[model samples]
Target chain A: MRQILSIATTTVGEAIRRRVLLIILLIGVLFLVVAPGLGVLSARSETVVLRGMMLGIIQLTSAVIAIVLTVYMIPNEIERRTIYTILSKPVQRWQFLIGKYLGAVFSLGLMMALMTAVLVFVFWLQASDQSLAAVGAMVKAPTMYFVQMSLLAAVAIFFSTFVAPLVNFFLTGGMYLLGSLFNPFFQTLQENQGTHPVTKAFAGIVNTILPNFANYNVQNPIINPTQVIQNESRYYLEVTFYGLFYIGILLVAGILIFDRREV
Target chain B: MAAAIETKQLTKSYKSRAAGNINVVDNLDLHVEEGEIFGFLGPNGAGKTTTIKMLLGIIYPTSGEGFVLGKEIGDMAVHRLISYLPERPYYYEHMTGLELLKFYGSLFGIYDEAKYRALLEKVNLHRDMTKTISQYSKGMQQRVGLAQSLLNDPKLLFLDEPTGGLDPIAHREIRDLILSFRDEGRTVFISSHELSEVELICDRVAIINKGIIERQGKLTELLHGGRIEITVGGVDEAFLKGLNIPDSNIRGLPVGVLMDMPEEQDPNGIIDAVRNRKGTVISVVPRRKRLEDLFVETVTNPALGGKPSVPPAVAEEIVK
Candidate 1:
């Protein structure tokens, strides 16, 4: 545990200082600050459009940050020979993998927290007629996006143990896209009575294999205040646990591969 | 002395599409006694690093067995007593020398600030303890690496090219520190290409070529059959050769002649001949066979333990 924490803290220190991640974060913040002006062009209510646009920027930015941060996490350590120094010590391979994953999560959370703060300030500054309760509700989506990005980091880390950074980048990005956009379309197809048995079976297997990133996507209800979710807190808890469970499995698989890898 | 490390038929092989089952480290045996500096010498891609990694438990051996500190290889209990510093290691640049030590120290659950300070002082990095690795010179980085390797007060230290690519002063500094490891009763295993550096520090050495142990013995035993040189000022190369000294090299110097021959041969017969010719005998010097000569002879020739083997392609390349 001590070894894992030490590696984790060191990883966090390195990740936060990376110029590429900081640049991505800066761009995310910039878009959030300017989102209110763009909301006026949309046909919907200005505040509603502003809410959706800001949340969309945060989700997109977090996904990119998660992928970029984790793709090279294992490979860079090997290339730089840092992993040898640590592994030659009493540290276990699983501990190092978990420590690195946690470090990526912590760094991602820090970046998302910054964007979330910016979102609040932007909403408060531009949507002044809105109530404080509305602002609080708006804060919930970025919080869930944090868990979504954490899962995404885990996906990248799992692939990184076996694949090169470039390939892992595309693979993890593709997984995210499939889970976010097409997962629901597939889910609906599987449930609809008129769907073919073959298509339903395929959807079932895909759903079973791919993590439902759409689980944490609670932006629509927050975007339009008229919508109501009866079991809001229960749903939040279930998705957070689901993300954690999936992250756990991916990490275990990654550690198994990394243990045998002759780095 | 008890053996600190011993191996029997330890091997590591990799399979490739074109070439099948290439043995990076073939059936090999090695021995390192407790509290001695053992030099592991080899050319590039000669399996020095692979052997070290297997011993360190960073990678598994394909077949065979090994022991470290009287424990089986890859034992976690053994790791607590051992440390490894690889070639050209990169410390976390964001960390100060002190912080780097702290982080590695924490791996062993050690939180003693005084120990960290003492280690820095031992490596002569006490003043630079607060400086991040990015600000340190190459020598300083290597020094800090040594400091971290000592965090556990290890019984064995494996250093791969500890003084590689450093200036004279830095080399001397690192060499002195390695020698001090022996004094402190620590077993030091070094894999290096710096022959002169190894000659200065290593108590015993093993030369491996193409993953096979070609030579292994004490420094003094392996380096034998030294040469004797007799220099005369007035004598020319032609006159020196005329003496017909057997098993000797007669060469012309800028202002004199030099006769180099085996150590067992007498120097008086040559001295009398040079004096009778009025060729002033300027000097007589006995030179021991150097490690470099032994390395070239052992690596280039395929014979080991009186058994002939195939020469490596790299050795042939060297001949060219």
Candidate 2:
């Protein structure tokens, strides 16, 4: 645990200093600050448009940061020969993988938090819903996005153990897109009896294999202000546990491949 | 003395589509006695680093077994007693020297501030403890590497190219520190191409070519059989040439006629031949064998398929 924490802390320090992630974060913050103007262009209520736009910026930026940060974490260490020094110690491959994964999570959380602060200040300044409950409600989606991005980081880290950074970048991004935009479509296809059996089996395989990244985005109702989830607290807990379970599986799988890998 | 490192038939191979399996470190036997500096010498792609990696458990052997400090390879318990500093080592540039030490020290569950400071001081980087790694010079970085490798007070230290690409001052500094490690009773296993450096500090050395141990033994034993030089005055160069000594060179020095002959030749016979010509003997100097000669002979034996470090023409010129 001591070795893990030391590696984790060092990784976090290095990650936050990476200029590319900071640039992605800066772009996300800039868009959120100007979201009020874009809100007026939409036909819907200004608060709804502004909230939806800001949340989208935060989610997209956090996802990019998560993927970019993790895809090169292991490869860079190996290339730079840093892994030789660390692994030569008493550190295990599992501890190293977990530490790197946690560091990515911590760095993504920091960037997302900065973007969220801008979202709150912008939303409060533009919307008439000035209640603390309104701000609390607005913050919930980004909080869930943190867990969502953590899972995405795990996916990227796992691929990084076996693939090159460029390939892992595209692979993780494709998985995220599939899980977010098409996961529901696949899940529905598996459930609807009218669907072809051949298609159903394929859908079932993909749905089971791909993480349900959409579960975290289910908090979209928080920003839309009209839709309500039944038993909101219970649903949030279940989704968080679901994310944790997937992350645990990905890390263990990554550790197994990485242990046998020759650096 | 107990063996600090031992390997029996340790082999690591990679599958190549074009050529079947290429054994990188093939069927090798190696031994290192405790508390001695052992130099592992080999040309590029001679499996030096691969062998070191396998011994350190950074990479696995496809077949065979290796042990470090009485424990099986890859055993984490042995890691607690060993450290490795690789070629051109890199530390986190964001960290000051002190922070870097603290970071590596924490890996061993050692967080003593005084110990870290003393290590830096030992490596002569005590004043640079607060300077980030990005600011350290190449020599300073190597010194810092040495400092971190000492964090565990390891029983065995594996250093790959420890003094590579450094100036004379830095080289001497690092060399002295490595010598001190042996004096302190720590076994140092160094993989280097610096034969002269190895000749100076190593107690034993093993030369590997094509992933095979071609030669392994004490430096004194391996470097024996040097040539002898006899310089005589009042003797014509033709007088020494007339001797027609096999595999010997007769040349003229400003001071006298010089005859350079192999160590296996009887110097008494050569001296009598010179005296029969009434030659005045100036001096008889024994030219000790160099690691360079042995390395060239082993690595470039036409059978080994290694390109000669010395061109064929140059070798024939000296022999003639």
Candidate 3:
């Protein structure tokens, strides 16, 4: 446990020193500041437009941050031969994977919190009237975004354990795109049940294997105050837990493969 | 006593589909006794690094069993008691020397900062501990590398070209440190192309060539074969006549001549041969067998000329 924490701390320190976390934070803040101005030019309702823009920005930024940082964690260590120094110890392979994952997640979590705070501040500045429920709903979008990014980070790490960083980057991004498209395909399959059995079955298998990142998109519930937040809280927590579970599975697989690699 | 390290028929082959396969190490046996400085001498492409990697469990051997500290080579517990320094030390460039040492110490489960601090002092790296490893000279990096190896106070240490790039003073310091390790009853296994350094520090030395052990034994046994050189000027025929040395004893050289005496023969016979001659003797230098000469002779001769057979007892003893 101590070794894990030590490794995580070192990872965090390395990330901070490299200015990766700082770059992500600066970009996220800039996006939040500019999001409200973009909402003003939209042809839709003001609150709804602002919420959609904020959610889209958060998702895009978080994905960029997670993929860019996590993809190089293992590869950089291997290239530098720092893995040799760490693996020579009594620490298990699983511990090293978990430690790196947690470190990356923590870094992303810090960025998410900072970006979400900036978005909330912008929302508060533009609001004519604020309610407790409205504020809570507005915060849920970035919170869900955090969970999705954490899952993406794990996916990047999993691929990094076995392949090159550039390949892992594209592979994890492809998985994310495929996972996000799952919900629409599932709805389509349900609408055309008689026509698309084989396609529906294949989509179902992919949905089961990859994380459903689209499920965490909760912008409409917060933006359109007329619509009830049906299943919002339960689904948000459930999807967060689901992302955590997927991360755990990928991390285990990574550990297994990395353990057998001759370093 | 059990051997500190032993390998039986150790072999390793690297396979690449695009390129021709090459066997880095093949059908080799090696043993090092506890408290002895064993030198593993080989030229470039001689599988020295490959053998070290296998012993350290960085790379698995294709076929063989190796033991260290009476335990199997790959065992983690045995690894804890063994320290290694690679030919080129690679470290985190961002980390200072002290930070790197602390990280290594933490991995080895050593929490005492003072002990590591003292090790830095011992390796003469205390002054440069605050500087990043990337900024260090090759010799300075080697010093830090040596410091890290001694962090756990290991029972066995493997150093590959430990003093390869060091200046004369640093090289001497490292040699002294290795000798000190032997004095404290720890085993030190070193691989180097520096024949003179190996000869100076190693109690027992092994000369490997083409993935095989050409000769291995006590330094004294290899060096004390009793070869001498004699030089004299004027009256060549008279000097030859005065010396009744057999043909086997007298071998011709470019400048002067070489004399090979039986193991039991005294130097007095050569002294008498020159003394009774009607000529002024310039110099009668008694040539002792050096590790460099031995290395050159063994490597140049595919079948070393009438070399003494390696005793089976020595091989068996190292295995145990």
The TM-score ranking, best first, is 2, 1, 3
**What is every candidate's C-alpha DockQ against the true complex, given to 2 decimals?**
0.74, 0.84, 0.43
* Regions of model 1 farther than 4 Å from truth: B230-261, B264-282, B303-320
Q: Which candidate number maximizes lDDT?
A: 1
Which stretches of candidate 3 lie above 4 Å from their native place? A19-25, A45-50, A120-139, A183-197, A223-229, B18-22, B167-169, B207-211, B219-226, B233-237, B240-265, B276-281, B286-320
C-alpha TM-score for every candidate: 0.92, 0.93, 0.84
Global lDDT scores for all candidate models:
0.91, 0.90, 0.78
Which residue pairs clash within candidate 2?
none
Quote the true-contact fraction of every model: 0.88, 0.86, 0.29
lDDT (10s digit) by residue, model 1, range B1-320 = 99999999999999999999999998889999999999998777779999999999989999999999999998989989999999999989999999999999999999999999999999999999999999999999999999999999999999999988888999999999999999999999999888888999999999987798888999988896898998899878888888787889988877688889988788998899889988899889999888887777877675564534335565444322
On lDDT, who's better, 1 or 3?
1
Docking class of 3: acceptable
> How good is the docking of model 1, by CAPRI class?
medium
The digit string of per-residue lDDT tens for model 2 on B42-62 reads 777789999989998889999
Reference contacts reproduced by model 2:
0.86
